[model samples]
Target: MIDSHCHITDKRYNADEVVSTFAEDGLEAVVTIGYDTATSIEAVRLAEKHERVFASVGIHPNEFTHEDSLDGILPLLSHPKVVAYGEIGLDYYWDEPERDVQKRKFIEQIELAISARLPIIIHSRDCDGDMLPILKSYAPRITDGLVMHCFSSSEELAKEYAKLGFYISFAGPITFKNAKKGDIIRAVPDDLILAETDCPYLTPMPHRGKLNYPAYVRYTIEKLAEERGVDFEYMERLTTVNAKKLFKKIVDFTGEKI
Candidate 1:
C-alpha cells in the first residue's frame, strides 16, 4: 500500500523512525507533503535519504503570507524526489489569512505546478464553493494531474472533481464510525482513487484519538476496500496503481514496478 499524502516532517514525530517502519508496516511508498518552504526542504531531505519516501512541495493556504514567495519552493520541484507540488489550496476554516490572499496564492502555485509539469496535492476546507470553480478553470492546464487530499466533501463535489480528471484521496475520516463515506468512496473511479494517512492529524479508527503515522494508512485503505465492496488486497493494489499513475515520479525515481 502507499500513503498518498502525509507530513513526516511535522516535528511532532521522528521522521527517520517513521520511514524506518515502512518495511514492517507493508507500505510500498509514501509522499510526504510540504505546507511551507522549510518543511518542503525537510521533505526533500527525507526523500533523498529514503528510497520509499517521496516529496511534494508548496505553501499551504493557511501558511500563506503577503511576503511569502514560491521562490524557495520553486527550486525544490527540480529535485528528482519531488513528485508533486502541493498541499496548497483554500482553507476558509481559518480566519487568519484573508480569503482573497489564499485564492491568489493558490492560483499562483497552480500555475507554477503546471509550468513545472508536476501534479498538485490540494487541501480544501469549507471553501468548496469557490474551490470548485477555480479548479475547473485550471483542470485543462493541469495535465500533470491533481488530487483533492484527505477529501471530506459531499458526494456531488467528489464526482465533480473526478469528472475534471482529478484523483480523490481518502484518509482516516473514511474509517470513522459515522463517516458514511461509502457512497463517496464508490463515486470515485477506481483509476482515480487514492489513500493517505495525513498524519499526525486524522488518525484512523481503532486509533482515532491518538497520534497518526504513515504506517496506519493501512486502516484507511482497509476501510476503503470495505466501502468499495472489494477485498483488502485488491483495494491495496488499486490505490497503489492510482497513486503511481498520478505521481509519476515515484515510478521514475524508484523504478518501482507497481
Candidate 2:
C-alpha cells in the first residue's frame, strides 16, 4: 500500500523513524506534503534520504500570506524526489489571509504546477463551492495529474472530481464511527481512489485519538474496503495502483512498473 499524502515533516513525529518502518508497516511508498517553503525543503531532504518516501511542495491556503511567494518552492520542484506540486488549495474554515488572497495564490501555484509538469495535491475545506469551478477550468492544463487530498466532502463533489480525472484520496477520518462516508467511498471509481494517513493528525479508529503515522494508514484502507464491499488486499492493491498512476514520478524515481 501507499500513503498518498502525509506530513512527516510535522514536528510531532521523528521523520527518520517513520520512514524506517515503511516495510514493516506494509507501505510501498508515502508522499509527504509541504504546506510552506520550510517544510517543503524538509520534505525533499527526507525523500532524498529515504527511497520509499516521496515529496510534494506548495503553500497551503491556511499557510499562505501576502508576502509569501513560490520562488523558494519552485526550485524544490526540480528535485527528483519531488513528485507533485501541492497540498495547495482553499480553506474557508480559517478566517485569516482573506478568501480572495487564498484564491489568487491557489491559481498562481496551479499555473506553476502545470508548467512544472507535476501532479497537484489539493486540500479543500468548506470552499468546494468555489473550488470545483477553478479545478474544472484548469483540468485540461492539469495533464500531469491531480488529487483531492484527505477528502471529506459530499458524494456529488467526489463524482464531480472523478469526472475531471482527478483522484480522490481518503485519510483517517473515513474510519471514524460517524464518518458516514460509505456512499462517498463507494462512489469513487476504483481507479480514481487513493488512501492516506495524514499522520500526526486524523489518526484512524483503534488508534484514532493518538498520534498517527504511515503504518496506521492500513486502518483507512480497511475502512475503504469495508465500505466498498471488497477485501483489504484488494483495496490495498487498488489504492497502490491508483497512487502510482497519479504520482508517476514514483515510477520514474524507483523504476517500478505500475
Candidate 3:
C-alpha cells in the first residue's frame, strides 16, 4: 500500500528506522511530506537514502512569516524523488500567519506546482471558505490533480472539491469514536479515494495514543474498507492505484526516482 501523505521527517522517529520499516510494515511506498524548508530538505534526504520513500516540498501556512522563500523551496523540487508540491494551504485553526499571508503563499505554491508539472497535496483546515475558491480558480492549471490531505470537512464542501477533480485523502481521524463521516467516505469515487497515516499525529485506533508510522496506515485502510463495505485488500489496491494516479512521480513500488 502507498501512504499518500506523512511526515517521516518530524524528528520524533528515526528517519532511517522509519524508511527501513516500510516493507516490514506492509507499506509498498511512502510520500514523506514537508511543511517548512528544514523538514522539506530532511524529506528529500530520506527519499534519497531509501528507495521506497519520496518527498513533497512546500512551506506550510503557519510558516508564512519565516525567512524561507519560494526560491529556497524551488531548488529542492528538482530532486528526482520529490513527488508533489505541498501540504500547503490555508489553516485558520491556528491562524498563525494571518489569512492573507496564507492565501498568498498558497497561491504562490500553486503557481509553482503548475509550472513544475507536479501534483499538489493540500492541507486545508477551517479555511475552506477561502480555500475552495482559490482551489477552483487554479483548477484549470492543476492538471496533475490535488489531494485534500486528512480531510474531515462537511460533505457539501467535499463535493465542491470533487467537482474540481480533486482527490480526498482520509487519515486516522476517520477511525475516531466520534467520527460520523462514513457517508463522505462512501461518497468519494473509487478512483479518487486515498489513504494516509499522517504519522506521529493522527494515529489510528488501538494505537491512537502512541506514535504512528507507515506500518500503522493499515488500520486506517481497514477502517475505510469497513466503512465503504469493501474488502480490505480491495481498498488497499484501490488507494495504491489512486495515490499513483495523483502523485505520478511515484514510478513503482520500488520508489525509483523519476
Largest lDDT belongs to which candidate?
1
Report the poorest 10 consecutive residues by lDDT, candidate 2: 249-258
Query: What would the per-residue lDDT of candidate 3 be over residues 1-258, giving only the tens digit for each residue?
Result: 999899988879888877877777778789999998888999999888888899999988988776448777889987888999998998899857888878888888899988888899999888877988888888988898899999988888778888889999999989889898788898788888999999989999988898988887888899999999999999998998888888877874354322
TM-score of each: 0.97, 0.97, 0.96
Which tens-of-lDDT digit does each residue in 17-115 have in candidate 1? 888889888888999999999999999999999999999999999987644877888779899989999989999998968999899999999999999
So what's the TM-score on candidate 2? 0.97
Residue-level lDDT for 36 in candidate 2? 91
**Model 1 residue 152 lDDT?**
94
lDDT to native, each model: 0.91, 0.90, 0.87
Candidate 2 at 170: error in angstroms? 0.5
**Global lDDT of model 3:** 0.87
CA error at residue 60 for candidate 3, angstroms? 0.5
